[model samples]
Target: GHHNVQRLSTVYTSMGMSNADRGAPLWKEKRDTWASVCDDCHSPRFARENLQAMDEACKDAGMKYTETFKVAENLMLHGMGEPMPKDLAPDWSGQHIWS
Candidate 1:
């Protein structure tokens, strides 16, 4: 079917993506970000050991190690892949916290 073909091709393309080409280095980059947010929002320090342990736990539970994180749609839609927007400022006041 069309869906299976699409999924297969997606898997192939994903397999071909180089480490640098991926938006974020999943385990290192995103997990660190999560650790920072967690420590800030909860108890004490964000230990490297804990993060590594958590990563190990996730892997044991059939989680992925690395993958592409490219925001393709938003990149195309919001002119990120096109010309830069004028006067780009951080609008923290906006109620819609999509970012």
Candidate 2:
């Protein structure tokens, strides 16, 4: 059984945690904290390898999201999305209908 929930940096990021600083991102500090927790039950080398794998996975996902946002923005700019919320009528539930 593997347990590493305490080191889920992505969850912290999603919750709007500040990893930014005046000079550079605080990624190293966060990584150190994660490694410290992970090292409690695992060897330092094992913890480091797992953390590096997680970092690469997060980097790849961020790149994919950047590309996806660009495509969505381009489509919206070209008027590909028809009947936007502003043009929709409010339904009985007081919410704008997508139809």
Top lDDT hit: 2
**Cα RMSD (Å) between model 2 and the true structure?**
8.4
lDDT of 2 at 35: 70
lDDT of 2 by residue, 1-99 (tens): 245665563533531212223123545666666677767678989978986775566556556656776787788889995544754532343321211
| C-alpha lDDT of candidate 2 relative to the true structure | 0.55
Which lDDT tens digits does candidate 1 get at residues 25-81?
Answer: 543554444445456445435445665564455444322213212454467677877
State candidate 2's TM-score.
0.55
- TM-score for each predicted model, relative to the true structure: 0.27, 0.55
For residue 14, what is the lDDT in candidate 2? 35
Q: Looking at model 2, which ten-residue stretch has the lowest summed lDDT?
A: 15-24
Q: What's the C-alpha lDDT at position 18 in model 1?
A: 26
How many collisions between residues are there in candidate 1?
0
